[model samples]
Target: MILRRFFSSSFRLVSSSSSSSSSKLGGGCHRDGFRAVSSMPEPCQSSPLSDDESCDFDWDSLGFGLMPTDYMYIMKCSKDGKFERGQMSRYGNIELSPSAGVLNYGQGLFEGLKAYRKRDGGFRLFRPDQNALRMMTGAERMCMPSPSIEQFVDAVKQITIANRRWVPPLGKGSLYIRPLLIGTGPVLGLAPAPEYTFLIYASPVRNYFKEGSAPLNLYVENEFVRASRGGTGGVKTISNYAPVLKAITRAKSRGFSDVLYLDSVNKRDLEEVSSCNIFLVKGNVISTPATNGTILPGVTRKSIIEIARDRGYEVEERAINMEELFDAHEVFCTGTAVGVAPVGSITCMDRRIEYQTGADTTCQELYSTLVGIQTGTIEDKMGWTVEIS
Candidate 1:
């Protein structure tokens, strides 16, 4: 069993905090039930620049990379099988061994979500509870400890409140929240580690574009299997990601943003993307690959299905074979990062199937509606929105 860590040196041992009047991430920066000690134990190395440089990065010229923030949230879990809640601090480098469990065996899981300043000029999280639940599911699958949903959500809020300046205005951009967990126990044996690290950080980001307002051009490889029956496909583990990195890079070189994977067995049915879940629109019905224990149950994917249904669209959760989606009116992917992305074409060995990409379509409607709710422009009748105080 070979495991791999996401970053070469992402671990940072820190002990400190700055001034506490940060923005409200879903964590409710000032909640008293779960107190976030605004204290620091370690000095920060990556000292932050002036507030102008930190928050005034061209939101339009953004790419996916870490822009140093004022702080982060981290907590430790002991080998005695007990853990403690966390607090916020300055964002900087992490300290880990060259042979940490996450480095050797890849025992880890993570989650992605964001905080956005609403039209009313306040911050909000779109169904962050869903992210908390997904993180727990990933934890269970990785054999790692799970942070309580409340604690998890609160940590995010505290960190966001501390870094509120980064939360983009309603139409400009958004603050990206990354809650990461990895096994920290040290050993040479290829086994699950008893200790792990759970940390949540934020990055301000712009939109993830697919192609000229239409669906994406994806290459379907029938030979490579992403996740097997009983494998950790549904779990968002760091290990689950490394295996697909090569495949994804290869696909990108071939003019694709991502690769559409098949089930580990038959190589016929669809699984999901390297990072997001897939969906198909056929007539008035909607379908996505069922969980079947081999796909990540994305928070946005679930919410889209529910929102579409409430708007009177039919949805199906079952095996979605390659043939079915290739013939779909539209194929899109969903996750906290990209929101909902449309796939316009699927490239096989010698052929490519194309569909409508971005105009008046079901996927776009869903995307717009979902974004609206997150930015507080749409009525959140389902009560999924969590407003930060």
Candidate 2:
């Protein structure tokens, strides 16, 4: 009822393509059963940056918020069950019915990836293929048709290039790419919608948490459960996120960076933080909660597991008990937005456990290595970085 009322009042119909000039890229054309549109007003001929607009933004102060860019990629599917080719449209809002599946039934999924400005003036995307694959898996579960891996990658690259000026300087920040798929068609009953919309947008972001790469203080949430077995926890569904906002807000109000949720059934094993995957280190062994049904298999978490193993540190994926976490030498979290952030201390129940978070810590080393590879300063021997042409 809340989402229904909000959509009914706020949603606006998208304008026609003929209203503005079109600039097509990456083999996306109107002949592919689709039409491209630029939502810019008259006199703004193209979507890319002009010579005068190149140095206008203050890249240093860009926080992790929605600073709308020049363009977005959008595609749609009809009730007949055929997905049309997508096109680049100027960034703006779109209309939707009050009974849209996403509003009424929570039928939607999304992905997050970043594009970095290389030292040589080129752009690169880190492990986008993983995001593509994960999105396909999420779409299958959410009962929506998803773009193919090639289509997914191409759309991301095209949108990133269209908004290239917003990519920011090398160390300032990265352009965060968000790919969203939602059931848009109106539905009366609790079922899948007849139509869907797939949209990709880019926003310049520095860090998810206000504490950039600094150590984080977390509250172990034994009261609220993040997910349960056979739930939508393993996928990047939009429905899985809103429920955690209450717990995260409550934790932050008390001066904690985020909430570390425990398993729902036992309340002893660690699940994950609100947005990032958690990792614990003891001596030379690095252990994290296994991605059993309830945990999200984070792309950053996967990359770190390989990176740590290649660096000769033993890594294990299993259920991490709270008692073991309190005794660990170091704690950290990994994600696309968080990168690699060390945990300073965790307040579980009434006891507070603190860990060493100095410059010489293992998490600091991993964070540096991961960020260096992402920003193109370190040699990428793992073949994870993809250049955006």
Q: Candidate 2, which ten residues in sequence have the lowest lDDT sum?
A: 1-10
Best of the candidates, lDDT: 2
Error of 2 at 387 (Å): 0.5
Off by over 4 Å in 2: 1-55, 78-82
lDDT, candidate 2, 1-389, per-residue tens? 00111112222222222212111111211112223344444222342354224435787787888888777878776433544556666676666778888889999999999999998887899999999899888887877777667667777877776677788889999999999987777789987776677789888899788987678999999888999989999999998899999999999999999999998898999999999999999999999999987899999999999999998999999988899977899999999988998999999887899998979889988988998899889999999999864
Whole-model lDDT values for every prediction: 0.72, 0.80
Q: Candidate 1 lDDT, tens digit per residue, 140-251?
A: 6666666667667777776666677777767777889898877665658886665666678787876665452346778887767788888888778877877888898899
How many clashes in each candidate?
Answer: 26, 0
- State the lDDT at 301 in candidate 1: 90
- The residue-level lDDT of candidate 1 at 289 comes to 89
TM per candidate comes to 0.84, 0.87
lDDT of model 1 at position 350: 63
Q: How close is candidate 1 to the true structure, as a TM-score?
A: 0.84
Candidate 2 total steric clashes: 0
